[model samples]
Target: MSKGWWAVVAVAAATAACAKVEAPAASDAWIRLAAVPGRPAAGYFTLHGGRADTKLVGVSVASVPRVELHLSRMTVGDMMTMDATPAVDLPAGAALPFAPGGRHAMLFDVPPALTPGKTATMTFRFADGQTAAAEAKVVSAGASGPE
Candidate 1:
C-alpha cells in the first residue's frame, strides 16, 4: 500500500513541474513568398531565450520536406552566398534575429499552399531536447516583412 501511494505522489509532482515550464517562441515569424511547386522557401524570425541560455540547433515543418539553419553572407570578392549553419547561441533574455541577408532557415520541398496570407506551423529544435513551436505567415515575394 505504501509503495502504491508513493508512486502516485511522484507522478503528481512531475506533472505539476512540467506544467509550469515554458518553451521558447519565435517573434514575428514569417516565410518568404513562395508559390506551390516552388523550389524552396526561407523563414525569418526572432528567438528570445528564457530562464537559461540555450542553442537553436534545428527546425522542422510538416509543410516542407526538409528545413535547416542557414546564414547569408558576403564573400571577400563581394559576392553573396548562403550556407548552412550548425547552431546559434541564445543567451537568456537576448533576442536572436533572423532576417534578409542574415541568419535564417531554409525550407526545402515546400508545399504550394505556403503563399502570402497563408499560415503554416514551424517547430524549432533546441540543443537541450526541448522544442518551441511557432506559426509563420507567408509573406509576399516582394514584401520585406509581414505587412
Candidate 2:
C-alpha cells in the first residue's frame, strides 16, 4: 500500500467516525390519561435523554389550552400539595418518569370530551431549544405503564 493511499484511508475512517449520528434527546415518551370527569386532567409520561443533558421546559397541546409542570409535594402541614415546577431535568441516558401523585403534567382547559381511546398530540419544548412531539392516549383512571 502506498503512503498516499494509507493517508486517504485514515482520513476516510476519521470522517466516518465523526459523522456518527446522535439519538434524539427524548424517546419512548408517552402519556396516560385520568378517568375522572369534568375536572382538570393529568398526564404522565417518560422523558428519555440522549448524550447531552436536557430539560423539559414546557408542553403544549391543542386539546388543552394550558399545560403546567407540577410536582406533588408533602408540605410541613403533612398535607400533599401541588406546585409548579420550572423545568424537569434530563440527564444523559436517563429516563424521567412523570406519574400520578408525583411529578406530572397538569393539563388545564382540556376539551370537554377527552375520553378513552382518543389521543392528544403534545409537543414538548426542551432546554436546548429543540421540540419533540408525543401522542398521549387516554386511559382509565389509575392506569400505569413502562408496560
Which has the greatest TM-score?
1
TM-score per prediction, in order, is: 0.80, 0.76
Candidate that scores best on lDDT: 1
Position 20, candidate 2: lDDT: 73
Model 1 quality (TM-score): 0.80
- In model 1, which runs have C-alpha deviations exceeding 4 angstroms? 1-22, 34-37
lDDT of each: 0.84, 0.75
lDDT of 1 at 68: 85
Residue-level lDDT of model 1, residues 1-147, one tens digit each, is 699999999999999997775566677888886544566688998997866788999988766889989999999999999999999888877888999899999988877766689888888988888788888888876788887
Q: lDDT tens digits, residues 1-147, model 2?
A: 999999999999999987874433444444555466656677777777766887889988766888899999899999999999989888877878887778888887777677666777878888888777787777655566534
> Which RMSD values do the candidates have, in order?
6.0, 3.1
